[model samples]
Target chain A: MIETEQLTRCYGSLTAVDSLTLRAEPGQVLGLLGPNGAGKSTAMRMIAGFLAPTSGTARVCGHDVRRNPVAAKKALGYLPEGAPSYGEMTVREFLSFIARVRSVGGDKGYRRFDEVISRLQLEEVLDQPIGMLSKGLRRRVGLAQAILHNPPVLMLDEPTDGLDPNQKHSVRMLIDAMARQRTILISTHLLEEVHALCNRVAIIANGRLLADATPAELERQSRYHGAVSFSAQGSGVSREMLARIPEVASVEVDPLDGRVTVFPREGKPILEEVQTLLRTQNLEVSEIQLERGRLDEVFRHITTSAHPGPAA
Target chain B: MSAVFAIVRRELLSYFVTPVAYVFMVIFLVLAGLLTFYAGDFYDRGLADLQPFFDIHPWLYLVLVPAISMPMWSEERSSGTIELLLSLPVTIAQAMIGKFVAAWLFIGFSLMLTFPIWITVNYLGDPDNGVIFAGYLGSWLMAGCFLAIGACMSAATRSQIVAFILTAAVCFLLLLAGQPQVLDFFQDALPAKMLGALAQLSITRHAAAIARGVLDLRDVTYFVASIVAWLAAGVALVDLKRTR
Candidate 1:
């Protein structure tokens, strides 16, 4: 539902968003992962028509953001970073104002307002002034405003920034429920959020896109280098002996627990072989397990090892 | 049009939800009453007309209008809500005009609260109600002029204090342009016709003409043109800042 062609935004000498071209299809949630000052928010703002790109163009549902901003913006809902809102207005008034501005007319507007309020669980604080609410509740109010028009595209920047654990869980469930109907582009530094909520992930660094892939695919690519841990008690089967195995690259003995951590070569599954060796040596094997690959490890490997180049 | 009306209603409602609007109203009404009754010599001037009441509007608006309008755009910018506002589907022109009209109506409402003074004039003696009505019309138009300038200045800075100061400085210069002392200073430095044209651009001059019960089209056109010019600048500035 949204596409950008070589989009760039430069502020004097510093480029906020480089020639970044990306797309999110309908009913797809694209998680934008980036470090601080990585142009993720700038990219989202360009797509939302809040900031004009210095070069190239962004289109929403096939409408150019610059040439036909009104139509393009009408099809998109944006929740800016920091959850910025009019502090003087009550939550209901603010949502109503956004509904009117978004042109959700007639019974549709009221229906949309009711749907978003209940979806975001903002019915309890609907009449409270926004300035009086906590950060988590205020963020929900911001979310309510964005979805009140039921736009086709939703661009959220750190939608779960300030929420507590329970609130965050509810918000994630809400987002997952809505993902079946709308295109979502979520920008956040939280890696687990991407794994839990997004079907596809785009990693950006220094105004560039480094990698874009599904969460499982990204983890599998990084898992070519894996680690295995097992416990055994036997005579003459030392941790050094385990390290000397052809497939094993390194071994470390836990100082307090005396357990060994084994790093195996790529495409090597030595668990059964190690068990057989223990049996042949008449050793007592305590535990044998494979460490599951995590998205955090992949995120670090992608951002740190990958070269910082212009966005694709 | 619905978007514009939505913005107008929201802005107007905001004024009442906080103490800003109430404080402004109290200050404006008190000062307007005190200036007209005590300073303008309303009862002691030996005139049954409201000339004294209408005469103090230029100076009163020089301060009150800025106080009301300084936070209109500056607060939005400072609080980061400007991003949310610009992201809406409404164009910058619609938002600017909507905010300006809302502030103008607020000032108009405040001015209307001075009706007791109008009543007092009619109760004491026979005065020309047409002239009083014309004076009110002229005052309301001049208030619009001040609000337009204040709106543009508000758009220029994120600091409301700075906006208020800049608006006051510009408005004070406009008010003093046609005064005898200022004209005398410029008479020797510039050509006579150029100086005359500069003086004619002063809001004080046109406001005075209308306050004297003369509804000259040129004076009316001057106020309208001034409002349009400044509000247009406001719209352009909003666009520029949003793009940045």
Candidate 2:
């Protein structure tokens, strides 16, 4: 439902989004993973018809954003970074204004407005101005404004940036509930958010797309996938004893928690070898598990490997 | 068209929801009243017509109109709401005209509230009500001209103070273009034809012609044309600067 062809944006000498060609199909929640100043928001602004690309074009549904901006924008709902809003307007007044501007009026519009207000739980503060609301409440109001029209496509730039953990869970639940038969492209730097919400992840850095894959596929890129980690009650387990196994490439013991981890070689599984060692040595293990993957390690590796120079 | 109407409604609602509308109206009415009666010697002149009242409108609007328009587009840019606004299905032209109409209507309403003076003129002597009506029309039209210019200046920057200063500076130049002293300064350096054209560009010239009890098509056309030109500039500026 969302597509771009060599979409690029430059500010003077700096290229913010460089030759980005990507697409998001219906029923897919694509997570745009990038560090700060990675042009994620710039790319989104071009696709949302808010910023004109320096070259190439983006399309929403079937409408070209550059050629038919109004029609293209009609199909997608966008929450800009920081979720900026008119602070002087009440939540009710703000949503009503957006509905009218989007032409979401009449009986069906009223029903949709009611549903969004209740879904965002903005009933109590409907009459209060947005400036008086806390950050979490204001973000909710921004969400309500975005989804009020019930558009088929959504492009949210960091939707859960400043919300508390509980608020973040509820927002994720809302996005999850609306994920069926709709295309949602969300940009976030938080790695756990990708595992919790997105089905697919696209990693970008310095305005270039580095990796795009499913969450499971991305996790597999980490060295810790299929590795075994356990905490023992005694000093029976040592790095040298665990590293002696052929499948085990290396072993690391956490200095803080005193947990021992056995990493595999060539993405091989080392759980059985670690279990055999525990059985033979009779190690008193309190906690043990086969590590699926570590997203942060994968994210850091993928994002950093693309740029090999000194840190600027 | 509905999108334009929706924007207009929202802009008007925003104005009334804060103290902006009340404060602007109260200050405008007070200043216009004081200038008309005290500065223009309305009572001492003892004329049946509202010549003194119509005479001070251009200078009065020079400062007041900028105050009303300084926050037009600058506030949206500074607050980052421009992204949300343009992301809607509405075209940039629609947004520009909607905001312009809303501010024009507000200034028109303020102009209308000076009705007691109109009534006083009618109550005291046999004044030409048609001429008074023409003066009101001309005053509002001139206000629209200043507002259009201010809107363009507002779109050029994100700082409201910068927008205000730029607007006042531009309006001051336009107001002085037709004055005799300013013309004399340029007379020796330029041709008579160029001087005439410069004089014709003055808002004060066209407004004065309209306030003289004649709804001349030329004077009305001047105001309408300038408003359209400035608003078009504003739309272009908005489209160009919004990306940055």
Candidate 3:
């Protein structure tokens, strides 16, 4: 539903977004992960038709952003960074204004407004001026405005930036619910938000795409891939015997729990041997699990790499 | 267009809902009264007309109109609503024209509220209603020209104070271009033909001529053309800044 071809934007000598070619289909939540000045917001703004690209093309639901901006924007629901709004306007007034402008009104519009207000829990503050609201509430109002028209494509730049923990979880849940029908692109520096919400992640730095892959695929690229840690009950199984297994490369004991964590040799599956020891020796096994590698390490490696990394 | 109307509605709503509209109207009325009564010396002149009242309008608009229009685009830029507004399915030209029209009508509303002075003049003397009506029209058109300049200046910067000062300064230059005392200095520096053309470009000259009840086509076209040109410039500036 969203596509860009060499979507480059430059300001004089500096390029903000460089030759970025990407596509996000329906029902895919693509997390645009990058640090500060990483061109994530710049690229999203171009796709939303707010900023014109110096070169290349951005399309929304098959309409070119530059050639047919109005139509392109009609299919897009954009939440700009910082979640700015008119301070003097009340929440109801602002939402109504946006709904009218977006042509999402009459019975259908009111129903949509009611649904979003209640869903975002904006009922008590509906009549209060937006300037009086806290940062988290303002961000909620911003989210309410974006989804008011039920556009098929959503371009949210740092949607969870200023939200508290509960608000962030609710927003993630809301985005998750909408993901079945919308092509959602959220740009953020939060790696956990990507791990929890995105099916595919694209890492960028210095206006270039660094890595693009599924969360599981990205984890596989980390050194922690296929590692396992287990706990034992009632005089825990010996860590020495567990380390002697052929597939085990490194073994460390958890000082707090007396559990053992094993890093298997490269391309090795050691779960069978660890389980066999429990059955053969009659050891009381409490817990055992396979670990998907940490995304922060993987994100760091790709974004800060000296050379371009592989893309999935 | 509906999109244009939507923008106009939002702008007007903000104007009336905030304190800016009321404060501007009150100050505008007070200044109009002060200019017509004290500076223009309405009773001391003992004239059975509103010539003095009409004469001070250009100067009155010079300062007051910019205050109304200085925040037209500057506020949006400062508050970051410009990005939100531009991202919608509206053209740059449409948003610019819509906002310009709203501010013009707001000035029109405040101008219409000055009808009490017109009524008082009629009761006090046998004033020419035709000339009075023409003066009001001239005032409205001249105010529109100031608003266009203010809007363009406001779009060029994100500071409302800067917008207000720059617009007032530029309008002062435009007004001075028409003055006889100002022209005396230019006569020695430039040729007569060039001086005549410079006088033709003076906003004060056209505004003053129209205020005297002369509905000259040239004056009308000048106001309309300048408004169009300035609004076009405002749109161009907005687009240019978005790329930055």
Candidate 4:
């Protein structure tokens, strides 16, 4: 479990992380969302015990971060931003060093070591220096080190930030596999990642919690929620006819793609009505999707509306 | 602590994994031998002792110890690994002590490789082995002082070159604190008592005193005190100036 109460950090007069309070249970994968410079990394650093908070407190597995950092850290595994490690050391050597530092030695330590290495699929690069590994491989190495000790709480700052699609998928699957057993907190600007991995999402802007809800709930806050958008073979769909539907609030034609979107009134279901309209009109509809909600729109709405924040 | 030991092992392995350890050892060994023979005139003195060898350590370490200690924290900061290392179940003090001890041991290892000199002296004449041991101990202690200072300077910045220059400048000042020319420059500006105390702070003075084949508690305490003070400051600086 991870719990932080009003955790704040200031560099000089500028506040990097403001009064922020959050919690993640064992079964939760809390996705911390924000735009660039939204203090996501800074908040993770505070919870991971790398940066001391200027005020408030954070606790990991019941250990206060400031009062008992070592104990707190013992229960937490943190993958810092950029996935930094000792680049000069081989992957095996680096993991072994982490094992030793974490006091994970002897038979049990070796077992756990092999388990993590194989889980992360790092056997092939075990002898290669971390510096020589590709960016995606290095990220996997970072993930391997974080999960080596199998701590109850894992805080990863942008775990799959720079990985290719396949790597991102594998990492997401790994997180999904681990989600039920540990409280994993990941910060990312990737909305798709938030949907794929996070059960609970917390959106921050200007160092304050703007919204905290399930991915679906945050999506519901998007203007696209309960809206039906379709692309016709040509401009055969009339905007006024769709807008005339009583449940429909507004009809919008995407200027870029010439797709027409029929928005519902107060998030009423409009997919059925839009389908009936399209069939009766004898319009050639190519594709259509009822957005659960557009997280990107919600994200922009929450972050950009707030003051422009500084990046750490 | 196991954490400290782990860090020390990693640091030592890192030193050897690159050419750094070999280069430092070769240079230290070559320089110590050359200075002892040419400057100390071992043949003219007709003494089997390694006194002249011990005398040259302060100057030797002044330029070289920074090489060992400069990367202690600077590299970590620059590469962004300070976050990983600090987030472990280790305190800043543990990390500081671990890195410091690792560098100290590396220097001690190089000093030990000078066993050929010890063996040659023993083979030639009856040198007081006890005094030679004491000299070696004192020289190691002095090197510890230099390493501690360099480690502290390394904590102050992310640039290794900056750390090197800063450590060298401070070590240089400390080395010359007891010199007659330096004292004369300050004699008119400071009180006689203060000047005496300033001389007492010179790392070379305590090192030279121990090189004379004596291990006074005062001299040992000076080295221990210097190490502790510098390391304490390093811990403080790491907390204060770490990259965000």
User: What level of docking quality does candidate 3 show?
Assistant: medium
Residue pairs in steric clash, candidate 3? none
Q: Which regions of candidate 3 deviate over 4 angstroms?
A: A231-243, A252-260, A275-288
- Which structure is stronger by TM-score: 2 or 4? 2
Residue A200 in model 3: lDDT: 94
lDDT of 4 by residue, A121-145 (tens): 9999999999999999999999999
Question: How close is chain B to the truth by TM-score, in each candidate?
Answer: 0.97, 0.97, 0.97, 0.97
Model 3 per-residue lDDT tens digits across residues B153-192: 9999999999999999999999999899999989999999
| Residue lDDT tens for model 1, A1-312 | 989899999888898888888899998999999888999999998887778888989999999999999888899889999999988899989988887777787987678778888888888998999999999999989888788887889989999997899888988898898899899999999987987799999998878788888887777665533566667764235666676678877776666666666777775877665656657767676886676566787778777774665322
Q: Tell me the RMSD of model 3 versus the true structure.
A: 2.3
TM-scores of chain A across the candidates, in order, are: 0.89, 0.96, 0.89, 0.95
lDDT score of residue B20 within candidate 1: 77
Candidates sorted on TM-score, descending: 2, 4, 3, 1
What TM-score would each prediction reach against the true structure?
A: 0.94, 0.98, 0.95, 0.97
| lDDT for residue B150 in candidate 4, whole number 0-100 | 96
The reply for model 4, stretches above 4 Å from the true place, is A234-237, A306-312, B242-244
* DockQ-based class of model 4: medium
lDDT of each: 0.86, 0.90, 0.89, 0.90
Supply fnat for every model shown: 0.79, 0.86, 0.70, 0.77
lDDT of 1 by residue, B3-45 (tens): 9999999999999998978898899889989998999998898
Best by TM-score: 2
N/CA/C clash count, model 1: 0
